[model samples]
Structures are given as structure tokens and as C-alpha cells.
Target: MPLSEYEQRVLEQMERQLSSDDPKLVNTFQGRASHGLRRWVLVSLGALVGLTVLVLGAATSNPLVGVLGFVVMFVSVVFAFSPPRRGGPTGVVGADGEVRRSSPPARPPRSSGLLQRMEERWDRRRDERGR
Candidate 1:
């Protein structure tokens, strides 16, 4: 549903008035990027808590539990460092202070024998020639 020009102008005027009337609210809406950040932070904290529990269990005469805790901690650390699917660092602050990166372009469900096929077939022919 596209807005008509009149509706757009009215909405813009309303937004301008509201922003002037309540700058704080406008800033909160535009500047906040905490949803994804909060999720990642909570997951990291959960992993840390679980590791602590395993460590306590290990101290209580379960050596296997201790090993599991160590492994979990390692995995958690790796997860913390792992980049997002967009190839940018997760939990990282960019120039705009947001915790997200430019996302990768999504591949189409059906490739139309475009770039990928050319690359793959080029390598296949090279490999066949080498053999």
C-alpha cells in the first residue's frame, strides 16, 4: 500500500512535529540496535553459566564433567568470535556504532547457469586436462 503524496506530506509533517516535541523518543527509535545485541549477549551469558555449572560438577568428583565444561567453554569462545553469516564480525561496533554488518547478497533459489556454472565448469575442465 503506497502512500499518496498528500498522505506522505501529512505523515512527514506529523513526524517532524513529533520529533521536535519528543526528541528522546525519536532518538530511541532510530539509535537503538539492542535487539540482536541483547540476544547474542544473553546466549553468551547462558553458555558461561552452563560452563560454570559443569566446572562445579567436576569439582564434585566428576572429572568428565570438568572436561565437558572446558570443551563447552572453548566452544563458547569460538562462537563468540565466529563471524555472522554476512562475513562481518559479530558483536562488533561499526562506524555507525551498530552491531551488524552489511549482509551478503542472498543467492537465488534457482541459479540460471550464470556465474557459478561458469566457475565450476572452468575448474572441472582444468582438472580433467591436468589428469
Candidate 2:
């Protein structure tokens, strides 16, 4: 089922918070989040060129040509699968279908919270056990 508008708003708010809190994770997951069509075109072109070269090499029975084609294919495939370059504005598309630009927080978080929370829980358990 489609999310209600309220839920969408909540999700967008959470996304905004996450993006601000951990830009690294946001960047990692969302990539540059722009120029997707261009990226796809480049990948397809690279793969096509690589495949053509491979076929030409096979037809000629040339070891050097074959090796070159193999290298090209390998590199192109790697580039295709690699994450987009980290540049440009970061954005997250909300369920409402609006793109929200999110800038990184001015300062890095002192702690990610999970570790500190776990430590607090551990301390509480230890104290409880002692008592």
C-alpha cells in the first residue's frame, strides 16, 4: 500500500535527519544522486566498445588484441559497477515524489549513539547486578 502523506512526511524528515547526521552513509547509499541517465549511457557505451573490441580480437585470432579487449572489458565493467563520483549536491527523493536537498551537518557527530547507548546499557546492567 502507498504510504499516507503523514507517513511520507515522517520518512522524509527521518531521511533529512539521517543525511544530516551521517552524510557518509547518505552518500554511500544514494551516491551523487544525480546524472543517473548520463552514468548509464557511459556504462553502456563503454561495455559496447569493449564487446566490439573483444569480438574483433576473436575474429583476428590476435593475442595482443584479445588481451587489450579483455582489459578494456574488465575496466569498463568495473567502472559500470563502481559508485558514482562524490560531487554535486546531495539529495533524497521522498515518498511524496519531491527531491529534498540535504546538506551535511556543520560538525561531525561526537558519537554515532549506538556505541554510547550500548555502553550505557552495559553500565546499568553491571550496576544492577552489583546491587
Q: Whole-model Cα lDDT per candidate?
A: 0.66, 0.75
Could you estimate the TM-score for every candidate?
A: 0.35, 0.51
Could you say which candidate leads in lDDT?
2
lDDT by residue for model 2 over 37-103, one digit each (tens)?
7887787888888888888999999878878887887887898888767774566555554556866
- Each model's total of backbone clashes: 0, 0
* Per-residue lDDT of 6 in model 1: 100
TM-score of model 1 relative to the true fold? 0.35
lDDT, residue 87, model 1: 28
Q: Clash pairs of candidate 2?
A: none
lDDT of 1 by residue, 1-131 (tens): 99999998887777766655554455455553765596588668858876896878777988887777777777767776775333234332333344443345467687576898899799999999999
Off by over 4 Å in 2: 1-19, 24-34, 89-120, 126-131
